[model samples]
Target: MPQFVRKNGFWGVRVNWVEHLNKKTVYRRKYKQGFKTKREASMWANKFLAKANSGELVEQKIPTFPDYFMQWARIYRFTHITEVTKNRYIVTASHLESYFGSKPLNKITRSNYQEFLNEYSKDHAPSSVNKTKGLIKSCLDSAVADGLIRVNFSLGSQATGNKKKKLVVIYPNVEQIENILNLALERRKPYYPSFYIIITAILTGMRLAEICGLTWDRIDVENRTFKIDRAYNHLATDKEHIFKTLKNESSYRTIRVSHNLISVLSELKVNGSNLVFAEKNNPYKVPYSNGVKHPLKKIIKDLDYNLGDFHFHSLRHCHVALLHHDGIDWYSISKRLGHENLTTTLKTYAYLVEEDKIKSDDLIETQLDNFLTIGEKIGETSKKHKIK
Candidate 1:
């Protein structure tokens, strides 16, 4: 029971408890004054004692928003996430520091967070704003779990940003793709690995990181297939040419290659190096994906293809387009491209699918018309025979 007393013309309460510190028992007391009546003091003491007995009372100092966020990320996110993902968290921390400078995590209200996002969206793209918001929301969720904040202020917050239309997907046509492939094949040499990487990407529809991490052991020349299990971490800070697991389980797949592609890969393989796209002079190192862009641009210019913003990733899109042209289904294309689901392939190549649908509709109409015309001719011939 708490002891009640009257001091300085106000009622007060004193609560006592026993605590253990470093294997030593210690007695602790808490005092609260300025209550108007003994009943009020008694009520407050009961609540405080209940919290203390239940072990819910925490007396640690609260950290600022940015400080807590950085600490949370270091403990929970740094080791598990990629270098690029870590940079995004760091950037979000910087933004929090700029907006909430020295503000306690619990002191920031939902309105304050919404205002910050509103200001941030004025100059950033919608996608960028959304990413930042998502990162902060995750951090705030951890804060709530840690008993640092009562609520996640970012919940139900709306992110609005500069409205810029996304660019259309432009891939190379059949003639242009053939020209690019031929040029890459002619320029490919033992010392130049970009051309080889280009050819592999076009044939396999592999991401740049996957092609860079490809090894000779993963390829089966007899079966004409290669397995994708890992990828090169290009922008990693800890180590160069480090191999990392694929993005997801769907990304781990076996791709069948044509005989000609197998022949090309065989010719490029070196006796000592296991990597298929190793560096020029050093067989142990892999070339960066950016290294392929210059040569790819040159090829496009030489072929006079009018593709805008053409880059290394365009090869993957070109592969999809070629498969679509060959009358392959979306599910097959999705699997070939290592997509997580058929919906991803459909959404990404919706224009191509729409075009195919239009062509199919026209063919269906034409075939039906021909069949009805033939039926009418047969009916007229049968009527004439009956009259005779």
Candidate 2:
């Protein structure tokens, strides 16, 4: 029989192996998890006994890190998460297969993980390497939950300590955005859901998937608002499109349509059943998934928008940037952009570094006008004194 008891500030695992011939042997090791109540300790005791009796107790060494990671992906990840998310997990795992595949679960060390980060992630930005570390750590943590390993050995790795990712934060100014929008509107060739999808996306910082999910049913013409209840995801073409809740509960809020967006939707008012951005002629069609060619990038090139660092996601960035230029605070912008926190909004749209300098220069021009007017008045007074 295995049992649990509190010793000093910890709950300990206690096991008694029954000898069929005569005596019994008891072994115990205390873990540092402080149980607030006796019930929890009792529960641990019951579970320990069950595992010991079934011979399912976690051994000191059972599987290699490589072996356990694959098992974790199948047993824990695939059934629980979104398909797109599951695929991403698989992709993250696949990249790791080359490095830690043969290493034993019990043997992976801090130095080896450090070597991987220093040798590989040093060239990459701090943030990208940080994401890689999280995914890999999550895989290993699941292995810990599965009892394949006792402790998370990579806890102190350099990648885990990376402060933040250094993403390129170059958003277009107002004139640049207008130029891009006008350019997008000029495209009548492929019949982009230009009138609805492209305009809304460029104006509102909602994700590409969220724009694809917009339906006429959810639109409010009278109030000129749109609800974002969910985001449409079709990350792969080989599979069916996926429907998931908005980025989070906070993302489910309503967003006011811009005047231009309202007018465009008015122009797009066909008696449609499903999507505002649905395929025009084929009323029954679903929109393109992630694998399909996103025409925004191509349109930029066709229009000769020799703009620098302009990606589709930049349209979202531009939305937040324009609001920032209009003097919206980070908290308000964070809500509108469906960010979980202000920190995220700052990370994404905090590129207004030279704002004060630009404003100062503009202010100097206005002050110069006032200064010149004073000089004219002073000269008139001097002339009047001379006349006197």
Candidate 3:
């Protein structure tokens, strides 16, 4: 049986649940709120008891999809996840909320979810659609664990994400690299630090976040090495950004730098601030990604490099490409880039590896041709000596 209660200008229903577990009876009372009127509450209570008696009531209550996801994020995710990750999750939630705001978590069946994804796929990329589905599945997995839902219905979607063969790796050649360095030294841009940032990234292959988070204390001038242990989360101009943990374990590593870079760094004043690339006025803080991007674009335009869609990250790719061209081993490049796995380096620079293989083949063919010519000359001498 169930009972109706009224409080805080709202009506609620209280129902009892009993379960038999290993011959032991477990009893619990579940309460649900948000009824508009007492009669509505009474009707719900009656309906709940009937369902419970018939063994059709599985969960205590079903929450609206948006409401549950929002609550879950606030309670379980906000503190544990990184700021960037939290923002991504929030974006996913907002998109899902628009579609399933009023629907209960338990009511979203597999067919319903599949249909939703099918519609979402029409407007979004396969990767994005899959990412959204992944997030929803994660949220629903927690719901299943809490006994809030009988099963995660966000599973078994037939729409699959496209497999990415390789990431696009673009970088400047030797002549271009030299030209960039010369340009940086030659030009005095309005954004003073952009050139320095570009040069450092080309030399070190550090990510934009790592560059923003770099501090002088982490740099060893004598050893010619810099440690990358964290990344910066640039939220706003007025608000102070935070230095958070590195992307992964491998991202925290020490990379050797050049003596030329060392000399340049030494010339720059440490400026009462720890950040090497900190803004002029706010010496304690580094510029945001946009701050780096705008200057980089301007420099590319000024130099007339003819590089399309070139950004700060392009410098990192350029660094990797130069190293590969200089015959640096895959393992060494992976370590220098602070990649968690060598596979990442191998996959990223596969085109470079293919080029190296072609060179090797050419060298082998040239040696084989020389050996055959020598053999032919020996045979000709033998025949002439026999004839004499």
Q: Model 1 residue 374 lDDT?
A: 100
Q: Give a tens-digit lDDT track for model 1, residues 135-204.
A: 7889899989988888898999997787663234467777778788899999988677888889988878
For residues 194-262, write the lDDT of model 2, one tens digit per residue: 434566777888787788777777788788888889766555343245455665667888988766676
lDDT of 1: 0.84
lDDT of model 1 at position 253: 96
Q: CA lDDT, every prediction?
A: 0.84, 0.66, 0.77
Residue 253, candidate 2: how far off, in angstroms? Answer: 0.8
Q: What clash count goes with each model? A: 0, 2, 0
Which digits, one per residue and each the tens of the lDDT, describe model 3 over residues 71-90? 78888878767777888778
Sequence-dependent TM-score of model 1: 0.81
TM-score of 3: 0.73
The true-versus-predicted C-alpha distance at residue 338 of model 1, in Å, is 2.0
RMSD of 2: 10.3
Ranked by TM-score, the better of candidates 1 and 3 is 1
Q: lDDT (0-100) at residue 1 of candidate 1?
A: 76
